[model samples]
Target: MNRAWRTVFIALLTAGVVGSAAWLVFVSPVLGVREVRVVGNLDVSAGQIRQATGVADGKPLATVDAAEIEDRVARIRRIESVRVSRGWPGTLMIEVVERTPVAVLPVGGTFALVDRHGVVIEIKGVVPPALPVLRLDRPGPGDPATAAALAVVGALPEELSSRVAEVHAPSAETVSLRLRDGRSVVWGGSDRAADKARVLVTLLKRPADTYDVSSPDVVTVK
Candidate 1:
């Protein structure tokens, strides 16, 4: 073939290949989503995640927006975070991390399970045995007393936290813990929590009715 003719033929072949690939990826049903796979979710169901994605089956995979799907799924209050990814051929993958309750708060009639940030994760008819009761005038993300109580609880070691029955925070500066036993802990505030936790661990070894580690440097026991 002539040189100019060969060049034209090659150019046409390339264009045809690109166009066919684009059609298969963006328009043809061959590469469309057939299933939505949800993972890393326990409280939220796969059906709920799929519905939140708003992606219809048989829609071209390449045309799906992962960021938009993530934003939609994150709107579910129980979900702490969500990630969306496209699986090859015909699948959409959604991974979600649900909020975990750190404490329970008494509302009007029911108990609210709240996370470390004091955001209510769920409502329960009765308090769970594993979580401590948080005593505060108002329990919410915006409440300072709630914030202080959660901060103190979050700082406690797992072993120590399991013994805790209630967290009382009348104000931001006054936080205390009531152990499952009659023992009480004066936690003071959210500040120096790590130091207070370390100090309290040592103080608990001594038999005392009340342990004050609010000032970690100068602990008081009675």
Candidate 2:
């Protein structure tokens, strides 16, 4: 064949191959999703995650929108974050990160478990023994008292936090903690949290009714 005819034939063949591959990947059901796998979820069930994704079985995997799925799953209150990815052949993988409750607040008959940002993670009939109780007028993300109380709780080391029974914050500047053993701690505010935590750790060595590490530079025990 002549050079021009041969070149034209090669171009047509390449276009045909590209068109077929596009059909198989984007339109054909050969790569359809058959299962949705959820992982890294503790409070949320796999079924719940799958339902939130809104991806029907046998849907074309390549056509699925990962950002849309993530936005839908994020609407679930307890979920901190969610990631959606395709598992090649016929699977959708959903990874979830759930919020950890730092304290519980009494809300009428039930109790609300809140995270460090004062976002309510869950509601329970009874308080969990491991979590400290928050003493505030209104416990929510917008409430300053709730924010202060949760901030103090978040700053505490795990060992100290385990001994804390209650966190009180009437205002943003007056945060305190009541230990399980009945001792009090004047935490003041969220500023210099690392310094205050260190000083408080050392002050607990001495016997005292109240430990004031509000001013970590000048700590006091009474």
lDDT scores in order: 0.92, 0.90
| TM-score of each model, paired residue for residue | 0.92, 0.93
**Superposition error at 161 for model 1 (Å):** 0.9
Candidate 1 residue-wise lDDT at 71: 97
- Candidate 1 per-residue lDDT over residues 113-210, each given as its tens digit: 99888888889999899899999987678999999999888988998999999999999999999999979999998999889988888889999999
lDDT of 1 at 54: 97
Cα-lDDT of candidate 2: 0.90
Residue pairs with clashing backbones, model 2 = none
Which lDDT tens digits does candidate 2 get at residues 1-222?
A: 999999999999999999999988888889989899999998788888889999888888999999999999999998998899999888999999999988999999999998878888889999999999998976679988888788888888987989999988989899999999999999999899989988888899899999999899998999
